[model samples]
Target chain A: MNEIRIFSPATVANVSCGFDVMGFCLDSVGDEMVIRKVERKGIHITRIEGFDLPYEAEKNVSGVSALAMYDAIDVDFGFEIEIYKKIKPGSGIGSSAASAVGSVFGMNELLGRPFNKTQLTEFAIKGEALASKCEHADNLAPAMFGGFALVKSVSPLVILEIPSPEDLYATIIHPQIEIKTAESRALLPKEVALQDATTQWANFGSLIHGLHTGDFEVIKNALHDVIVEPHRSKLIPYFNEVTKAAINAGALGSGISGSGPSIFSLSKGIENAINVKDAIEKVYAKTGIDFDIHVSKINSKGIKIIN
Target chain B: MNEIRIFSPATVANVSCGFDVMGFCLDSVGDEMVIRKVERKGIHITRIEGFDLPYEAEKNVSGVSALAMYDAIDVDFGFEIEIYKKIKPGSGIGSSAASAVGSVFGMNELLGRPFNKTQLTEFAIKGEALASKCEHADNLAPAMFGGFALVKSVSPLVILEIPSPEDLYATIIHPQIEIKTAESRALLPKEVALQDATTQWANFGSLIHGLHTGDFEVIKNALHDVIVEPHRSKLIPYFNEVTKAAINAGALGSGISGSGPSIFSLSKGIENAINVKDAIEKVYAKTGIDFDIHVSKINSKGIKIIN
Candidate 1:
């Protein structure tokens, strides 16, 4: 009860039509973290492997989120954290979110689950803000609650967990390049055309309906981003080609995963997802870009206890 | 079947967050029309009653939609329409849509139902455009398909019929004022702040989810119009007071019914709807506006066969 190990999932935010509001978790891509309660009265980061990130407890994402959760609780004992970061930071697949959610989720479990998912998401976004320079729950909610999550509102913190289809799979390609979330977000216009906004909401509503009804054709037709992708895609090399390749290879839909450098496509099954991954890989290979491709089932469980 | 008699329900469109895409049909507010097949090869409006309207088939809302549908099919006989209109034009409770849907729905039945609902909507919106000066399916889809409907897209014509909660009811108050749909639409800004747009889509997506799950609290919270109501409410006298009265009297949500002079509020049951109606009537009565209030259950069947 004093110690916990958990798998915190990588997630794809922005999901085309649902920019800034929707996301889905990945089962095969994540980071593992171990948290142990200590007698000391402060949070500590004992170890971090596989990625060179800030180790200072005050500066780290996991530490910042854990501290937020810690300050709100009356726990006498402190927590020691060790992270095995597999999802690379700035790859646009919610690496910071995985770490952010990991700390809060693990800490909550060790404290006998004092906080609900929404509260955990609230704490996690404080950490997420450190990385994105914005407090958004799109990635944090899905990584903490799993399946497809829609951050309905951040102020009151309403998060709806949309049902993921049984056979839904994702193919993600993380190009070995960094596109800072803050910089990519800065490229977006402060205002959008009302007509374009209308189209975006229509598509977003349709996509949610499609997910609920498990209609692939509706999903494909509705998964389009008219607001953010056009500007952000310019930051990532060969974004259009990769998306085309994914769709042509049978993905239900494809788009820039988050603030880009990573692109994701959703398909109906693992086989189709593999095909999409291969198609994307072929395109990325020709671009002479080093990349990592992952084919994964949509994670139904967000953060899992790993004994 | 050489002739058909039908009741075409009026609709409330742009339901708060779902501006331009969402609507619901009403049981008590509608128009009744009778259509007969004739040897002549054209559409004709044979009789006019209850409300003064254009008798010419080319100019009348019903006749215009009937012609659109009539020309598309290779029907052997022309159609004669007798209209008993109950909904008032420029009232903004989709009077044009009821008429438009009435013709197409009655024609489809008289011809042994040749066209599907989507095709019928296509014809109906042609007539709606004549009144509103824009082609929108929010009202038409609900009028044709009944209950709650989302016009996911207008061009490709994807309509999603959302299930209404069993106990849902509507209260509508028409203040006997005129607000042209075209003029109201012209009042909207060409562009909107990205933050407002994001909030709008969030509420929209949440509203859809709330409807699907039948969660009243979620519906109440999500039933906000940040994008349109602020500007359009100015045209409707005592708009704020009426809305506040409805909410205070236990209506789930209230907003301008279509491009309003008519204000609509949805409540959980008939009793609440009546209470809301009384409350709205009280507010409008003090303003010296001649108003008509109607309380009815949600219409599950759109264009019903009367005889």
Candidate 2:
């Protein structure tokens, strides 16, 4: 039955120091999955277009999470699933989160919308868990609710809305490189000094205040992360020089986009955003790295289907 | 030269996880210091009413900070200083901060208000260093600016004003037994796990959201301190039972107020606040502890001269 067809958007997680609990929906950059009920009483999965993708059901992250949802809810139904992977697979954005959220969002519509955002978020979290062993909803909430969002607590996944500055623009530069999430995470320290942690909290507290008050300078200062960024930054070839140049070129702040390889710089306007993108691209050019630069507004709306 | 006389309030530093970077004005409970320009060559000191407090000029925390401004600016001026201690000594609620802020606030006024809140806070922090051996300004901002506040970054002392819930009521219970702030601080760990730090950031991030959005429940869940309160809670007698009782009796959240010996439970209204306060007081009574309970609204205005 096509009555259950639904679409979900893509999201970004760890919006600066909010590791597992903070994320937001961007109007641009996302994926869409459509689920349909069938009388076959079995799950069937097939890639709609891309030949660079997997074909196995059990191995496919989306199929696994969707199957898990059906099994958990004990829903006796078969489904046909199609994924429009608008967001590039390894963009350091929420690629799988978009899939998980899409399947759950579409499946719920197919299943009479039995769950609310929190409940759906719970199911989507399971989807994330199936992929990462840990359920990080920073990417999910923004995908689900559309606009800047946060998960207050991960245990219950208390997602809250974060204030977004209107004049802000983001420039994302993805230098084609392969650094698996596992390897990236492994490079991070398992423990940090208490003083550094306090600094993180202080920055985080101020970041929220800046967002709420629409003060960009506070946001700029609060974007400093002494815990993860410093250690993981070494992986990227010219992270220091590029970031420094970006800031010098009038970008408000810059950081490793998501889990790295890609870099993002936030700016106050279009000119500053373009300068940030150009600055980041210049570093990749010096390293003989091929990259794609996207200068866009903070996508307030997360995921939407083009078709 | 009778310049305008003004009194600055005492503040509570280290709101559990927000160490050295968070404080709020106590409109009612704080010390008062008056500054009036006099025909003299140097600053003079006077300790006014309130429990016959010590008036050690050379080593006085406020006196030292106020004196630093004169040395730095090289403006030799004469002024009469008076300290009317309102908040008790060794109380976790910024006893030292009151005098520091008072002196700085008064000195700024005496100096034609050349120093803004940040500068005054800096001077106040210098005063804090003389007493606590640490330079911090959390208490000074709230003492100077009033309402719920965030100190943000310490080096530059970036102060921010967080929106407090409209009906926020603070029920402070001070047990007669004294607990030194240094001892309470000493009980904390030097290092914290990555997972725990992530959780703390989630809580901290949520706290800002709670304060900004006025979500009492979010604030309640976000008020926990994994880094400090867990370790420090053991030192306070009946801390466990008091917190349990307060939460059970409709308190949004409860914790060791400031450095403790004094415990505070936050509630949305008078009835719930009183209920939580009485419940905790009842628990304290079981241990035969003599405690004074103060049930009042969060004083948005810190310290004001009555006469």
Candidate 3:
């Protein structure tokens, strides 16, 4: 086919106990993109709606990722792109990742799927680096391959797709505030105590086991962050209150979604996720901050073709 | 019912990428112990053989663990322990754990199993602390529950039992040298770079996934230790050469078994394990170090009842 339309998902990165390594996709929140093959020999952005982002092909994340994929292939025809951005930028929910994954995923489909998930992630992360100022695949992997993605390494780029429980759901709260990725990252210390690192890895290993075994109790116990959250959470208002509210409302666990300004909690079912969302909403309402909340099932499919 | 004989398996702990948290049991290397009940009201050590150890109930590891178990229960009779120890102390292959696990496992069986595995691990770690000078369950959990064990946490201890591949085998080479656990631990840096910690946890999470899916390639790639190996390997002479030899001989991965002196390598089958053992032995032979090599299958059953 010469044309393709796809739904590229929003994702939660820096999952508790799995900072810089783990992330999962969301089904209910995403961005829509359409790509069409043209006879010309260059990539072009035909339209963008709902968010003011750089429209220049070289400046946009979608364009950068598409260029990364496009350069690796021998395609005679060029591509035209249109994006309907719904996941806001700097909301800590992988807005840039959606754009980055969308372009590569759609281009691959249009080219009859020449690249695998790992290659797609490599190309997507190049675009992700433009936004985060650092290259990490935690968000890109899940948005590209779906379910739970564990980025085992970044240099060699190994992404392990872990199975999520069928009933698992996510509740996300995105406060409409911008926390620059570089500034948020600067809040972290360059070094961490060895003892704390051990605890983090222990919980990380246990969380992976819990997901495999479908044991909610293990998941609940394992969802703790001793490394990153203690520092970054201070940047987001009501962060502690929202997390406590989510847990009290029956979330398995809750933590800062990515850098800041967005928080996520995971639960067993849609009903419980809704309860967590409601509880978080009540906590955030008093802060006088404009925010958006979403309840999503774990998106096992990642980026998907759409009509 | 008054008397019980058991074989308590030795364990390899601090498996690469899972320091202080992961371990596995060995079928061919362990200690044999016999425990019997008497009309008295306290725990006692009746005989010692094969290895020299304290005979008192409180000072000996076997006795210490048994007393811990005995005091928590309303047992009507005192216990007598006869040890036919085969594992050497300071060998870094869970010699103390075998002794510690033996008394509790035999006593639990004799008392009709009043405590669960976690409780038993708790009691066993107390005995392990006598040897290691710290409380960590990497070895104890594997010796008690068998196969692979991940000590997910210490306080509110959580041990996750991971399934081993059917054909997995271990090759252990113990160079007859001494490295005290306390001294070995002191060589480590109290703080580690965040980048190194991230790399460690990534490999750790991937290793757990590899074990679950029985993927040898994933296991080979994931079996790495960036944090502890660089420092600890210095204590073990010809460490890098032995590890290289094992890998060259087709072992999946190799690292320091515990604190030091003993090096362990994992292979896919008994034949590969033997090949790895030969390779390791060849390297250590030139060093003029008196060493013992053991090839054993993965012990799925931790402590077995013996005649």
Candidate 4:
């Protein structure tokens, strides 16, 4: 094939108690990219649409991820790429990961799929590195594999796909505000109280158990973030009010999505997801934050070829 | 209904990555208790067998647990108990939990079962408080509920029973050495590096995913302890050697069972569990530590009435 179009789903990283480790793909919001094989011996970005991101190939996340993949397989193919950035940058919902994951995902297909999911993940994390000065797969893995994922180890790159309950729905509220991922991360403590860490991991363990067993009660009880949320929630306006509204609206659990400005809640079904969105909007509407609400089931089929 | 006999299985708490939160039960090693309802109006330990545990009603773990249950129910009936200590105390396993669980379990049967598992767990944790300085259900929950458990919160008493893979087996090596639980716990840092805590919880998340999905490779990859084990492993003799031997013998993972004299390894089946035992014995036999090895399937039944 001369060209392929791929859509990479937006993802919520650090899903509450599982900071820097857990993430899930979302169906409603995503980024689209088109890669076409060209006679030129070098990669080029033909056009960048929808956002005012850098056009320099070396600086863009997609370009960096493609370069990583090219280095990994030593491929001789050159491609022209067009990025349709639908997932807004600095959205705290893995906008960069979509570009990173989409680039490598498309590159693997264009190079006859030499790399596996894990290998592709390794190259894709470079996109995060370019964006945040650190390589983390919490976002990239879910964007590539779909569903819930646990990045067990980053060095050897062990990412496990956790089972998502079939009845689960995701409700995300992006308040049209920017919280830079790097700055949000910098807000976290360099050290944590041992007791708080224990509690956090305990919640993390329960969350994974709940996801696998489809026990909504366990998930509800375990959706606590003692480590990151306390530090990052202050950056988002009305975080506590919005989260409480989602929970009161029958969300199984709710917390800041990624670094926030976007808060998400997991519900048992679509109707409850809409309810949670409406409730959070009520809280945000009073603040006049110009928000967008997304209600969708978890995107379990991550980045996919459109045509 | 005059007398009852109950056995509570021993447990491996902390389970590498889940310090103070996760634990699983063992079938082969346990404690046995016999409770007889008497005409008196208070709880009493009439006979203590097999070990020189404190006979004082408030001092003993079993006594404390029984008293806690009595206080909760405000029972008027008195009970006399006999204890047979099989699980060694200060061996890093849930020896005290077995006693606490067995006493409450036997007492509940004697009283026509007034409380459920969670209620029983609450009373049982009082035994831990009596034994140590604080109330923790990491050991008691698994012993009472069976299989793997995550103590999501100790304050609200949230304990979730995690599903266990049927093929999983546990191999434990109690090397006739005692590491006082208090001292071992004291060895832990009051605070931990944020990066290490994140890695530990990430592993905890993956481990739960592996257990729920029955993915052995994910379990193997996630069987890491970056928090407590690094600090406590130094207290155990041949900790590194025994762990390596178990891994070489095809054990999926191995680590300090709780807070150090006992080390446990998990394997896929009975054969591998026994193989792990043999390998560990080869290392410990040279040390002349008078070790005892128990290889058993993951005990799904926690406290059972033997009648």
Candidate 5:
């Protein structure tokens, strides 16, 4: 009862049409953290694995989130968190989010669930802010709540979990290339055309409708990114050809995952999802670049207690 | 059936966060049109009532829509459309859309339903283009398909009908003032700040999620308009007071419908709808301005045959 371990799933943010607001979790790749009561009064990082992340409690995502949990609780409890990261850093698939969400989720469980999901999400976002320098819940919301989530606002912390069809499949490809989130975000335009904004909202609306109705064609049409993708896709290699190949191979929709270097496509069925993965790989095979492909369905279950 | 009669309902477009894409219909206030077969090989507007619209076939919305049906069918079918307008023109309640949707819907019914709802919507947008000088389906789509609708695109004509909770109520207030759609649209900035655009999409996404999930609090939070309402609401009399009054009186959400001169609020139940109407009326009573109020539920049945 004094020690617990949890796993937080990797997440894809933005989701093409909903920039800075929408995201969903992946079932497979993630980060694992083990929390145990320690003699010290403050949070401590005992060990880090899979990546050369900062071991300082104040500098790490999990440590910052643990600090937030301490600020929320009145008891003078202390813990040492050991993180095993499976998601690579700068992968644009919510690597930092997994650590942040895992810490808060694990700590809450270790303390016998003192806070609800919403409070845990708030703490996770505080941890995310330490990494991104801005507070956002697009990744943490889904990583905590699962399925598809829309973060309406960060102030009052309104996060809505949207229902997704059972057949929804996500095919993700992460190229072994690093694109810093700050550099990618800094490339965005300060202002966008009114017409493009209108189009983006329409797409976002249709995507929501399609998710509710389980209509694949509507999702296909709604998965276009008119604003962010046009600018951010430049950071990735063969972004256009890979997306086109996925679409040609029966993907319901395709787009860049999170920030860059990783691309994802959605399909209606497993066969189409595999076909899309192969089609994308066929294009990526030509570049001789190191890459990874993951075909997953919508992750309805987010973070889980492993031990 | 050589003769057909149909009524096209009034609609509230924009729907707060979704400008130019979202809309829903009203039940009681609308326009009626009667279509009958004729020996002449061309469409004609035989008689128009309640508005000083053009009698020429190419100039009238009904005539133009009937012409579009003729073009789509590729047959020399002659028809005469008589429009009885009950919805006031320039009231910002989709008056022109009523005529346009009524024409295409009645023509389709008289022609034995050759075109489906999507096709009929296409023809209706052509009719709307004659008046607004732009092809928009926000009003026409809901008037043709009923309930709430999201017009994804006008190019390939993607319109999706969204389901609504059965108890959802629409309370509308139309002030007898004229703010031309052209002038109102011209007031909008050609480019909007990226921050504002992101906020708008988040609201829009939440609104769609709320509508599908039937969560009133989500809808209440999502109904805020940051881009268009701030500028267009200035054109209407007592816009702020009316909206505040409606919300204060238990309405779920309130905002200016479409361009201006009319405001609408959504309530969860019939009693709340009535209370919202009364609260809005009490505010408008001080303005000494002529205005009409209509309380209705979501028009699940859109254009209907009268005979």
Candidate 6:
């Protein structure tokens, strides 16, 4: 078998009410993992890029995903995986998902595509679950299909590819800090008030409609997160300032992007998106937090060989 | 004005998450109202058709709405009103709203368009408070606009027109019975469980997206009305059968039309719509009470005047 160089774009999961159900892949921002087949049956992953957080096959996302796929199928050969981690962990940008998706997708080519995208999605889910402690599909769908896709129901793994609006621009500002999924989940209330719960769903419904129709105004109106954002906002140093600045700079809506420390804002066009990034970065800069801004459209192309 | 003839269509209010803020007009059955300026300075009631209703200027809907508009805007001439009721009252259909909108619309024409449709919407809102004791805009937007519209904010009255998907069919079946609005509304709890409310909103958000994108599958999946339907289902006889039957008959989704005694269902095409109607009506027929079935497309056109 031949060696393949593959890149899986980072994703934003739980795009407001989408919770484990919605996500979109970023075009240029993500992790790149490369895999090569060997003669014997086993999995080997060398750290080419990305932080070497854990190395055990069960503990490492990239290795575990490839190992699971190969073990389940009739693969007599082994594979070595390498990753280029451009998106930092805990960026609320689905860095973990990119690694797992990259592993499965890169290995599929070496195996002659024995499994469909859903089967590959399962492999990714199992791998990512080791870190997040929850089996959710929000992160996997975006990495699989790219662009703005909805994991309508994850039981059978259904993907709804919503037509990305012409002017849809994602202005993601990753504040240089870490807010792990565990701590972010810990800050939330076990039970929320009924009214707040209703508000969340209303926002969720509005966001879904907004994403589907590309109705920027509706998305703006519905960009509220009563449950998670309010509770988790304090975890970020300048959460309110960044969100307000982005909105003031013509962003359609801004929120804590999935267990955020790295806040993301969705804007209408490139100009507004840039303005949002500049404004948000200014506030974070004052806080002495280094940040990176990515201005891109919905990555309609999910996993690919970038190098 | 020489003469005024106006027809307002039936409307589905509280469309999913829009419980009170959203509604859309139906293309099929509604109410027809006609008014002519008389020489006298005071309004007079001439005739009523299609259903048994009151004729007094103070007690009747047409008389009350026409009187309100006349008082709000200066009218030098008196007028005679005629109403042909098509949508039965207390069917959870916009029965009272149709009359109110028609009166407001008909009078504006009789007075030579002193008030625009937007201005007349306020008068219609007044009628809503008069009937339901709650000021809701779900019915008013559709009644005035002719198609799918949203009541953005009621105090200032912002009615945003949302695009209606072309491939949609609404099947309305009015069971032969009555559930008074007060009684049905009474069944609802002011405070709901947090989890249930969240589910409702999520469903609602998806429903809105479905409406904008013309995705019937999303609409079907997101149609569970946990807040209103579950509690209110006990009021109508064989409610579960009707809903289950409509869904089983290929309906995109089904919910109580207004409050109940009427069930509203959606399908992708005309054939499925007819099937849903037949399936639901077959159950009501066995109870020895005939029901009215309305098969229609989403009314992109709200109110119309044909002489």
Off by over 4 Å in 3: none
lDDT of 1 at A51: 91
Better of 2 and 5 by DockQ: 5
lDDT accuracy of residue B25 in candidate 3: 96
Predicted candidate 5: interface RMSD? 0.6
Each prediction's Cα lDDT score? Answer: 0.90, 0.74, 0.92, 0.88, 0.89, 0.76
Clashing pairs in 5: none
**TM-score for predicted model 3 compared with the true structure:** 0.99
Model 2, residue B215: what's the lDDT? 86
Model 4 residue runs over 4 Å out of place are: A74-76, B74-76
Among these predicted structures, which one has the highest lDDT? Answer: 3
Candidate 2, CAPRI quality class derived from DockQ = medium
Error of 2 at B51 (Å): 4.1
Q: What DockQ values do the models have? A: 0.84, 0.79, 0.90, 0.90, 0.92, 0.35
When just chain B is superposed on the true chain B, each candidate scores a TM-score of 0.98, 0.92, 0.98, 0.97, 0.98, 0.93
Error of 4 at B143 (Å): 1.2
From the highest DockQ down, the ranking of the candidates is 5, 3, 4, 1, 2, 6
Best candidate according to DockQ? 5
3 or 6, which is superior by DockQ? 3
Candidate 3 on B202-307: residue-level lDDT in tens? 9899989988889888889988999999999999999999999999999999999988789999999999999999999899989999999999999998988998
Cα lDDT tens digits, model 2, A1-307, are 4634445654556666666666656554556566777776655665454425554656666777677777767656687787767666666777778777777677777777787777777777776766666877887788877767878766766888886888788777777777777888898788889988889888888777888888998889887778888887787778888888889989877777667676777789889888887777777788888777777777765554334
What TM-score goes with each of the models? 0.98, 0.94, 0.99, 0.96, 0.98, 0.88
Model 6 C-alpha lDDT per residue in residues A1-307, reported as the tens digit of each score: 5788887888887666555566777876877777888786687866655565675667787777777787787757778777778878778888778888888898887777888887898888888887688777778878888886666565666666656677778888887887767788778676666545655655665566566667787778877677677788899888888888988999887777767876778888889888888898788778877888888777888878756
Task: Indicate whether candidate 1 or candidate 5 has the larger DockQ.
Answer: 5
| TM-scores of chain A across candidates | 0.98, 0.90, 0.98, 0.97, 0.98, 0.93
